[model samples]
Target: MAETAALAVTPAGVATRRTVTGMLHSWDLSTGVDGPGTRFVAFLAGCPLRCLYCHNPDTRYLRDGGRTPAEEIVREAAKYTGFIHASGGGATVSGGEPLLQPLFTAELLHRFKHELGLHTALDTSGFLGGRATDALLADTDLVLLDIKSWDRALYRHLTGRELAPTLAFARRLADLGKEVWVRFVLVPHLTDAAENIEGVAAFTASLGNVARVDVLPFHKLGAAKWRALGLDFTLADTPAPTADQTAAARAVFAAHGLQTV
Candidate 1:
């Protein structure tokens, strides 16, 4: 369980010794595709994986963004409570990887759930899912789990990480009956392999808590970011998956009795 901490904001506006603080990237007051309804999304900074198609490459570094108190973030979100609640919406903590700052994430979720009475969600790659504590999951209402690829080799090539940990986390979430929405990226010749899609769809279908699936079409939307960062944009020439291709990928999930969009 997370214990309450005594704290005060420092002269620099950083909250000191009060619970935990995370590098704050930015916030979106309203978003539809992140979770269920309209959501107040907090994009934290930092990630463990070097994903090739990452749009916000700037967030790859820990503390690249200003260090902010979770309390401050929740207090800000409290302002939108009325609109969010009325719309059957709530707050989501997304990130380069929220679990990378597990304590901050847990404290933020706990505060919002108890103090502001918000329906909290976590959007993660599940790479650092092992960092999540029971208290964290207890406060989370839903999980937007991103399973980038199914095949281990492809997964490694895509995100510079293994697939086992992600799968383990997903299985754990399912075992706990936590509501989850699975997200997958469809990249031509990379992740769009028929066998890969089938493997992912089948695995997700086997999970009891997955309520929906999102087959995201790959795009070069982030190529500029990669270029700006002086990082090689390997997928710079990769085109977005066609509608027919996306539909075909969805069909794989549908065959496994899962609804995808």
Candidate 2:
């Protein structure tokens, strides 16, 4: 019985436990949600922002994703180590706002790294950069930093928050040499203005540490999610960004010598 109990730990501490709250979604351990390439991703619960174009309306509320324990998630992910390794992918903790649940986010990433030997990435708006602890930074391998808009007014209008902190976070992360993929959603006239895109590209260029830039064309895929949540869809009539618009915007960043994905 003692030997049986000892055997249960497995290579990744399978018997050890950790706490988690809300839904933990996983996919090909190498591809990322942002594009193709298998990746094991956990969409955590809760967020502080109220973006007008948010598609993950189901993740906005802290309680919406439901409660889940961390150990169970780690154990389940452990089962796919071979898949993760084979696909040249790792694990990513994304969210309504993964930063909102930093403790859980850090803990999960640490387990994946130290226990499971997995490459880990964090997808966040960096809205809570200062609020995040050093411990969290120490364990994160990469960051997907989303800059909603260049203009503060437009930022507040779109995300219901200020833009300074996000920029500050970007700078700090760069200073620390953290690999970051800057994410900008092309939201038609809202975030697609030439001046706004210029400013955003300038900011990203200034960082000098950006690994790549991702121009995500805005879509209404999450509109139904907002409706389901009984929330007013402010951009309900806003048309999605066109391919030409996205390509044009991508050109702006390319002009700065930044690689686009």
Candidate 3:
């Protein structure tokens, strides 16, 4: 499978605001996995990594979609503030990679946190984590950080990008005492190596601010997306990790004295 060409930033249909307007893709009213509770997920367009397992292949490009204003998005998400707050969930700015568009993502997060008083979370690969500003981290209440693979070489092979940027971002988040939930996808032969998992467990455990560790079992649910995009689904032959594998991973993290989910 070949990687995507280069990034292309689209500006058409963008909605302007006090700061910088954003080029948005779509939004979901509520869901459970994006954050703590029922989250109103805003799937922003544009990302730097080409992960083989990305479900939202459509969002990889920075093409224009339903480009709504950040304030407008916050207003729409605010409608469900009561329900989300009652359930302890809030709004999440997810992406291809939110950090790819640092200004717009930060603006959206800031409004969701201060204007609507909602708990804000950013679901990201952390590949573009260096783009994150201090203000953005401050507005974000939680980070659903995807640490793809522990081995630097494996990380590049798995995500088609360097691993140092993500590690730097994780260190910065920990230094700021930002709450984080480290997400690791368990693949069959490619990434389920015991040593690699141990490496990830060790690194995440070292971050004292990590509130939870979510060991995700790999799945081919995104094969259809790849087909639709005419892009290669590299993990089409990969099997999802079994329950026992997942349990064992959880045990590994638990042994490191880190909470697991």
Which sections of candidate 1 miss by over 4 Å? 1-17
Q: For candidate 3, lDDT tens digit of each residue in 115-174? A: 888999999888888788888999999999999889988899988899888888899999
Q: Could you tell which candidate, 1 or 2, scores higher by TM-score?
A: 1
Write down the TM-score of every candidate.
Answer: 0.92, 0.88, 0.91
Give the clashing residue pairs of candidate 3, or none.
none
Where does the lowest 10-residue lDDT sum fall in candidate 2?
1-10
TM-score of 1: 0.92
Model 2 lDDT tens row, 1-261: 000011235597677443444344333343555422466788887788989888887877676665566676788789988888777777888887877777677778888888998778888998988866778888878888899899999999998899999999998998898888999999976898899999999989988888899999889998888888789998889898778888999999999989997
Model 3, stretches more than 4 Å misplaced? 1-19
- Greater lDDT among 1 and 3 belongs to 1
lDDT-based ranking, best first?
A: 1, 3, 2
Q: Candidate 3: what lDDT?
A: 0.84
State which candidate has the highest lDDT: 1
lDDT of 1 by residue, 194-225 (tens): 88988999899999789999999987777888
Candidate ordering by TM-score (highest first):
1, 3, 2
Point out where model 2 deviates above 4 Å: 1-30, 34-36
